[model samples]
Target: MPRVFLSFRKVDSRWMRDRVYQGLIGRFGAGEVFKSGESIPAGADFAEILRRQAAECELMLVLIGPAWLEARGDDGMRLIDRADDWVRVEIETALKAGNRVVPVLLGDATMLPEASALPHEIAHLARLQFLRVPETHLAEELERLCAAVADLMPDIGHGSASPTAPAAPAAEPTVTMTAQVSGGGSAYQAAGDQTIRLA
Candidate 1:
């Protein structure tokens, strides 16, 4: 199973991000699902861990809420504008590794900004297709997201919730025919009896 990475700005989309993380964790298991804060040890190096996870994971779900783009850093600049921002680093790492990045829209987040509105490193994010999950439809959306993940990454089993493969058509039964013939010169034989056994 490919590791699934959850990426989002901490202040702007924490609630929705946590919800999405919980949903994915239930389907992909805690070990396979990677999220900051939840999976990291208190003393771990956040940057190093993020780089490792982003480089290794096969898919990254970027949670973009209404305030995501405008979320600011400690220096009062937009977080996405800062080249060293962890969120930017995570996205850049994943993109460099050629991992799939899924933009998840929340609370009416319509679409990402155009390349001109973003820094060069992550500008490509603007054109990627995204998934939206309105708060009211979170559960339904999560189910759909899980289905998409299953389709994209076939080896990840969702425990008891895994999609069932279509049952193969039953094999045709085998038949044996026997003909009874009288000891006569005529070559004709009585109608044969047949027996069929289901496999």
Candidate 2:
């Protein structure tokens, strides 16, 4: 299971979300961070997996971009107002699970909507202290966020390499093979640098 869950409206914050994912992965390793797009397996149940991850994760970062609050659906209604909205469900699940939920304001986003503007289940998000990642200070802000997460989750170690760094080549294993000719045929045995005797 992932240690951190990233919650965001794709239409509103895909770019910023991707950046934040990269930053967190760089600091916490890819296996420790969960973003829906890369974390979910193909042909799997979406809602079930999302809720399970949100509830099980140790930390949930809610990425709120400039258009997050105003993002509308087909009928011009705000997406967050819908109970079935993926972002809302993720936040609500995390909150209900009592996981550490951090609001990340991206780009020009300065604040969250009023409590009355959000659903009852997620209204507390409006009152939480949020982290601001301005366009000009993304890298620094991301580092700060990583430090904060590390402080909150002592089990997660900070990776020295970036998320896109290539993995080192695996060392080749050494094997020893022995063939014994008995009464009828031959028997062969292989082990890791170990000789086997057939009797």
Candidate 3:
């Protein structure tokens, strides 16, 4: 199974992130997908964890929401402002590490100005697959997302038994018997025409 790292603006799309995480787990099994919210350990360095996970993952999913382009952190800094915003850093690291990056549009949001102007190295994401989820149909949207995840990381669906396998053949009885009355004794006999008919 391929490991996937999810990057999103925490304050802007926390709920959607969680939903995506659940959907991924349902499709790929819980251990195959990793999210910062669930995988980060207490007292761990946040930036280092993000970088390490990005490097190790086989794919990275960027959740783009309405406020993603403008959401500010505790330091009042937009991710596009600092080259090292955890989200931006994770995406860049994943790209440099030769991992696939899929940008998922959560709402009708556009990329931030700085992000929009990023070089091909950072903007290579524009050519990758993008999925848009309408807010009204989140569950359905999540199913679509899971399908895409399974498609990109085929191992998620591989090696698993299909839900629609053919049914097994019915068994047949191997023996039949008949009661026979003889002149001096009663006996059980096989139900075959070859038996002697003594009257």
Candidate 4:
């Protein structure tokens, strides 16, 4: 079964995030999905906890809005430029761990900027395929998303790698030959796609 990770700048897309989380939890079950504030307990080392949890998830849904890239740090620079930005860190961890990442464009958000415009750790976001799920048709989009995830994480119900069958084993062929002497009877044999000519 695949564990779900929801990544986003909360302030930039709170409504969309909340709705998406609800839809996913409904489809994937409560304990199967993960969100920062919703799932994380109040404790020391909260940042470290998020980092570790994000890395362990099997699939990640990144909700992006227009302001996600525009968000600025207290220093007035883009948050993405900061090494410790939680969103950036979360994305980088998922990428390095080979988790399936789905970029969800919310509201009017468009394609992400090129690698040169993003932090080195998360530049790969530019290349990841993104889906645009309109706010009005969230349910319909989620239905489609559910179908896709079903194929992507077929182990959900079975608690295994996937629901597909294992490949069949193959066998090697064996060969035998019989030759006739002067007074002995002749024998004949035929093999698939193989022809023998006699002089």
The top-ranked prediction according to TM-score is 2
Residue 107 miss distance in model 3 (angstroms): 2.4
- The parts of candidate 4 lying over 4 Å away from their true place are 157-199
CA RMSD for every model? 8.3, 10.1, 5.9, 12.1
RMSD of 3: 5.9
Residue 88 lDDT in model 4? 92
Model 4, 4-83: lDDT tens per residue?
A: 78898967878777877787766667677778777777775778777887889888888888888889977899998888
TM-score of every model versus the real structure: 0.75, 0.77, 0.70, 0.73
Evaluated against the true structure, the overall lDDT of model 4 is 0.77
Q: Could you tell me the lDDT of residue 151 within candidate 3?
A: 77
Candidate 1 Cα lDDT to native: 0.79
Find the 10 residues in a row with the least total lDDT in model 3.
156-165
Show model 2 residue runs off by greater than 4 Å: 158-199
lDDT tens digits, residues 52-158, model 2? 99999988989998788889988999999998999999999999999999898888645777899888999999999887777777799889888888888876854
Deviating ranges (above 4 Å) for candidate 1: 158-199
Q: Better model by TM-score, 1 or 2? A: 2
In candidate 3, which residue ranges exceed 4 Å CA deviation? 73-77, 108-115, 119-121, 157-199
Q: Lowest lDDT 10-mer window, candidate 4?
A: 155-164
